[model samples]
Target chain A: MSDAASAPAVRAAIGDSEFDRDTALVPRGPGVHDIDLSAGWTIMNAVNGGYLLAVIGRALGQTLPHADPFTISAHYLTASRPGPAVVRTETVRTGRTLSTGQASLVQYDDDGTEVERIRVLASYGDLDALPDDVRTTAEPPAMPPLEQCVGAEDGPAPGSVSSPIADRLRLRLDPSTLGWAVGAPSGRGEMRAWFALADGRDADPLSLLLAVDALPPTAFEIGLSGWVPTVEMTVHVRRRPAPGPLRVSITTRNLAGGFLEEDAEVWDSDDRLVAQSRQLARVRLG
Target chain B: MSDAASAPAVRAAIGDSEFDRDTALVPRGPGVHDIDLSAGWTIMNAVNGGYLLAVIGRALGQTLPHADPFTISAHYLTASRPGPAVVRTETVRTGRTLSTGQASLVQYDDDGTEVERIRVLASYGDLDALPDDVRTTAEPPAMPPLEQCVGAEDGPAPGSVSSPIADRLRLRLDPSTLGWAVGAPSGRGEMRAWFALADGRDADPLSLLLAVDALPPTAFEIGLSGWVPTVEMTVHVRRRPAPGPLRVSITTRNLAGGFLEEDAEVWDSDDRLVAQSRQLARVRLG
Candidate 1:
């Protein structure tokens, strides 16, 4: 175990935003850190997968030489709760362009046995150092202005569990896709929203990890009921987001055998594509 | 290492297809196998990323309890060549529905030192056992009749390297996007094709791994020159492909700082979605 004197000083820095403070990690040893899973980030009874990914990203940011995550892939083995957990990171390879590594988030049981919750592999690099050339053939999904959107805090559908993370994360939904919130579903299998942090923290590369998975399950639009548990998710950070709320659009094109796939794209205030993600989940229909 | 008598019998099967023969693995010990990377699958002297992934998939299929890959994410650390290699797989978790594991493909130097080539993590499950319910909102891309399309072996652009894997894999390209082959790019950043094995082998769940990446780089349509090395790729298998050639469509929505993302979707002859993939790559401009 590492002593307090050798701990990473980033955790001790004052005036950090709520997003940073909640995701802060204290170095416990080489390639290991102690994380405190904060409360009020749950969707149902389980901690949101994106929040947990952000926590892991924080640890990797400190452990690797690169400052920004280029790509991240995570597999959810078990549900995580708000409590004390440990993240063990191992360097997989270090190259001139990118550095790769893997990390596991684990919690302990009453019997002192370790229970692994999530396993992640990621590559890190400096996004600002990339070339300045931009060529885009795809445009952002059409969305209403921020003031015209439906607030995430408008309350959950009757009998559905409220997601406390929505308020903390500051999400606004597009009205056309909000039919699922009422008794009428559009059956389009899509969801669009605006994302920002409640604490006014400008979106960056690390926060983009959360933004990718922040939207409601697109399955909801198709009248699918029950918790959609994500089995695996991968996110590619294209560029650092400009300062402002992000425009997010998620769509589900196929749902088979009780399993569905959701694809998401995030555009920054500059309307640049910042990050893209895909996740596979199982629908536990009620 | 275990003696030859304890090796897996699947390698000794008499009537395996060329695809199976090229990807066969002989057990060396528990969770380890020896593989021979065959020649003629190169794209600029480096093995195709999808073909390498299939090699790793064969090992995971034998080690994990589940027989079909549900999701696979691979990071290319170094280019692979045709040679003798070894794959080591380690089980991560085994559940009632899915099993997860990780594998590494490494080649040895003349000095007896091992050089790691690719690192992959995958989850496997039985596709046949999944529920018989499928809901789809997306359709396959429109393509001309097979006779109206251009054959992959028609020849490469004047200065580009010819892909030898096309003939073996039986790929037919959509003529509308073939301007890149004539030095007059369409600048659409998209590629569509029909994929089938030349050996008359019916497409299966495992083969979908290779099918997702069988098309030409979409960047070619936008006039990007030089080798585009894939940094990382993730594929999600949705269903077992129906018998016949598959419809594949790949598109690049954004390209920034010399890095680009290509998204692909594969549909069976019945027009059912079988697999989807997204990859991040660096484009080395000539």
Candidate 2:
């Protein structure tokens, strides 16, 4: 955390590291924060969806009494062009244990009028009161255990692990699923990988946002790639994370109309479901 | 439509058809609407998630310049109790082709202080500008045509179809998938059906909200039932529907912490995908 002396310098170092700096919402009037968009948080030129949602989630946490974000939903009103954006939060509903509110990322136009980029609604609560009587008939996909997976350092895989986000969040792809990325494009849309912060910070509610949206668009496996911009996304934090990498999987059974919906689930190393998200995105067409 | 001469009288005639009535937002103070929740709109005693979202979506339509709701994201902040509620809309981003805003449902507490029930972020646009160059590999689940299906009119099976929402929305379930509701348990979490308005009114964006959530909770197939309140939900409109009933399929591959996420897709009678939604819900446990 940077102090008042080097706050400007911290803001200058944009990208994955700036994510920590950008989401830092202090107690100001109406929960204010100067959003920072640094490297790897971008696909082509626009800011990544998960990165924007994470910033909004952090701000919503500071604005509400309950801090652990149980759920967050975001609508991309327009293409969120990064750089010097203003985030503002408002209380929608302050409930007993959960509080809901809306946060907006706005930037100024050449004429100096504020233009909103993205809007989000988030719910916050503490872990002490998480639901207890949990049960599931369908289990998440079984991985080959952590020891058998390959991380970014493994290098030269079927598909290139190159992106602004891959630097901050290292991904370990299950070797079996790489045929679509590097070899012949598989007709099916699916991707499974293990994700962890490069700095070794344990995954948290904020980091889970990145983990969910950080994967290459599932449409890529079906042979379509080029900046999938999210139109809307919703994330549910099922449980807090343990001290380990997150096992993540994304699947898109339907890709149509220059659009596709991707469903993602994130499980901690403990094998507990940590977060689940689904998003609608427009596939960039030639 | 009821006239101002008998607004109170109409509010008393609750159920599926009133869905259209309850969500009719007039431009009062900041696009105002006195939410009317009649019977069946409630599960057990609490209001249903889809009912609340439909009401808010209607209000959002009145509040924005682009009237079509292309996408809506709602986070249930608190259990919405029945009775008269207030819904207000505020602009988040006013874009050229699309506009985003936040709408909230609130009620007064016993002490007369206003409390929030559900908060939503909605995006509105015109259907004339819908995506054209859309392509998807996955077609909606093949149905045996409408006549071959069974509707609630067929009467009692194993599980009771008697709910507050049953009267407003009529669902035609595929017979093979009903084992969990009756006879032996299916032991899986999934549900597929065709949905239409009970009143025979053409389904609109607001009505589609009802169609998505009106299904018997997928958890019921796995031996879990009762009130399943949605925690967070996101809906994306792919295209405007043609004149016909909607074909819907819901699947839940994970359930934990008294919470399960349901993914739903709606295809219009024209066999074109109209809308897709996913929501996290808490299954009521004894």
Candidate 3:
């Protein structure tokens, strides 16, 4: 992963970045695509849910006749690992303002028996076609200037973090919310941060899919840790994001019965709501 | 719709209620089922988003080789009218703890053309097989006793309420939050009520689905009215309900740029959190 200063060069090699490279779906024929998985997307022993979903989204975007992903949702049925997988797509609906479809990623065993892992449903639409009557009173979160925000340069030692996917994205966390880094979690289940590709690629709909779930689990602030597996996640892309870093904030209302919902809002630099996402995850007992 | 005085017969007909009857998908052939639409499920010329989704969900539940629905998500592609429609489902993934599938609802035009209207992605699981480490601190909202709650018996005159769907749902609306029933709105976009099938049927996943969207749009309380069409919705079932009324509450956080989100939580009479839902909808600008 590249630091902010060398991000452009890294961006140039985005085609080689584990993220961009692994998610690159090659169209083999109609309704089908070939994919290559990488360990860089793994957290612990399982593939990162968001990373796997981005691959599915990229495949749907490439295989289907759509310009941009308006909403991409995935239900994690089982764990996926690094290696060769196939994505199969089927048209659900095609409309003037939106196109809908479904895609699945599955890994084949030694005998070529495929086991399904991720199931995704996507809606594609022209961002420009959105109604201009946008109305919301949501103000941007209180964030320190980019310079004052803390990036990976100040994070835990190289071997300390649990997720390797973190190395792929550059996160400038809102300082006040970084207490978890020091082992003093707020115990409040909330997080605010500025995120962009470590390779400096401009944010896009696919990247927003990653950004939505790439952040550390807000449950960690509630002093709960260890694999917080997402059962399902749905994202709504409301506006086209302007090129720049994205500001995101997540809040967990209640962590009840080992199941919790995390709601996040993604805002562009101009304070426009670009996307909104909510995920249901099963938390590991403390 | 019957009142509490004749609740048993109402409950008896629940298995044959309009919502239940319309969503009782009958398998006509492989990956396809016949569904009948009813005006009882409509608010205007358009069918209720939640009602349409339950039909889709039930279809998936029946067509998919799975048990209970854990996650049911749908993105509305077009407005649907009450009539004959068919649901077509395709298997996405079949796993141990979870099974995933996709289904679509479509109606034929008078010209013999088929148009897709609703697209749904569902994750199924065996609730009994879930982990027993259930622990949550979520408490039911402060609601007065059942006797003190005001049922629809006291609502606006028959011709006043905008949504006819309310007549089919027995809602004991918390009176303090009913300003919108009059010209004076609460202006806070929030509501808490005791909800049940107007026919006195016990709550189920389908009813919960309807309940999520069946309420008068919270936007109305915020001084916004007219047809507030839901763009997409995701429902997460936390647990099965115990018999009796469900205490539920919904809140809208922001109404920005022609779009808004509503989050709702349903708690069984025993105060167990049963389901949680979040929906994104286009607002009717005043």
Candidate 4:
């Protein structure tokens, strides 16, 4: 992992280790900290969706004893409880080359009322070891490298917190990111941009997954609209790319009513498919 | 719901109460039940794939409050844990017209060591009470309706438990479902079939949803190989068809190696797209 001033910090708060005492902010743990539903980002009053994805990534990394290179391919579904919840995980099977684990997120009131629950299917194993034919033939579009990709002179306007929780997360758009991206030469239409995260968390598989999901606003083709929090996100991790130089790709599959299902492919500088995610976001135009 | 005479008598030895528990089973609370871990018709130690779908169906039903003219759709993302485990659901949102719920499932040893976990996304609400273009235009296929669809002669061998679970749950099937169904009308391809499930119990929305998932035997295309079960199911409920006479339509989207993904649509005799589902079944063909 490269450490540059522009790199995102990837550790849980110091002494803030109360939630996942058993696991590191990055990975390797029997358990992870229980995020306080009441604290943290407020989107929907449910735990911040970004944080939830981070935890899921951490749990997945820990469970996959051998899954060094993998990416989430698709998200078939999403379910969450409104609350501060604690997530726990169990490894279903761990093979020399393949493994499966399930993670359960439980939302509890201060009274332990058990408000919500979530389960995640984490698949881990060796991808490169698989036959060449199984590998994805789709290559990243050739474009000006990150250095050549320019950032928008004016970044996200000020006071743009559409959701109270998003506001609480202190999310900011960095202008330098525009130059940090390049779309495929094929004119796939989808844009790829790399942005700096506010917290600058290390790009662990989980954090990386979350950060990748947070596509820079510039990726959207249409003009600004209110941001709808993700109801649920399913990410398939294909392989781990270099820590920094996060590559974000965005595309929309089905859009209807006030809801849309979007997909993003996050890559490393090497252009290896790091993770793929599907999100159902409630959209609102400014 | 009416009970057919030929309904499997497997429930007899287990006694009337717990034996017939699959239909009326409710969540112990707001958590997932690792029902697949339990044993029965399929195998001794390995989980019976169909039972997992039944458990999920039951959980989805209880997550929503009682209402008339409601529907649900779900897709199975992965197969279930190999052994006995039951998942319970927690209601995420319970509104007068709409409700959302989440559940987690885990496997455990007889000593209570947890193993696998899964999460579910379910929504229930009353239909607009009026038909719209969104309604299903695909009229119920001309195949013989439910009762007349039975194939005592052409169906699974006299005592072949290998028959698709849908065949067993349904009172009968059209000639299309005779014996074991394989592939679509093109016959060159995917497995497809349609059937009807009786309101063996209350025939409520949840019950119907469970039936919808439990109906399709994606792993059994050629027929149940090992213990293929459902890990997670995502459902979408569009509209309701009349109660009693249930219509089930199934299509396999893709199948490769030992893994397969399927898309299923459930309709009522009236031809309403009651629910839609996708399932991932792990095949361990014997």
| Recovered fraction of real interface contacts per model | 0.67, 0.73, 0.47, 0.00
Highest lDDT model number:
1
Question: Each prediction's TM-score against the native?
Answer: 0.93, 0.83, 0.87, 0.53
Q: Output the better candidate (1/2) by TM-score.
A: 1
The whole-model lDDT of each prediction reads 0.83, 0.73, 0.77, 0.45
* Cα shift from native, residue B157, model 2 (Å): 4.6
Quote the positional error of residue A153 for candidate 3 in Å: 1.9
| Candidate 2 TM-score versus the reference | 0.83
- Compose the digit string of candidate 3's lDDT tens values, residues A1-286: 3465234563534355556777888788898888888788777777877778788888877766676777778888778888898898877777676678888888988899888887788887777766676546567777887768777777562335656666667777776777777788787778888888776776777778888887778887787767788889998877778877898888887676577888888888777888888898888775
Tens digits of per-residue lDDT for model 4 on A1-286? 2232243345444223322332233323576545444344344344455556556646666556864423232221234544445666666566565565656566565676765444455556564554322123345644455445543322333433344433222222222333322221221224456644334432445555555555533223333334555544555455444545566666543232334445566666655665555554545533
**Which sections of candidate 2 miss by over 4 Å?**
A1-22, A34-37, A43-45, A78-83, A108-112, A131-134, A142-164, A174-183, B1-19, B38-40, B43-45, B78-84, B108-113, B142-150, B157-164, B177-184
Candidate 1's C-alpha runs over 4 A off are A1-15, A152-160, B1-15, B152-157
Off by over 4 Å in 3: A1-22, A63-66, A142-150, A155-159, A162-164, A174-184, B1-22, B29-31, B63-66, B131-151, B155-164, B175-177, B284-286
Docking class of 1: medium
Prediction 4 global C-alpha lDDT = 0.45
Q: How well is candidate 4 docked (DockQ)?
A: 0.05
Question: How would the docking of model 2 be graded?
Answer: acceptable
| Each model's Cα RMSD | 7.2, 6.9, 3.6, 10.0
Q: By the TM-score metric, which is better: model 1 or model 3?
A: 1
Indicate the residue-level lDDT of A184 in model 2. 66
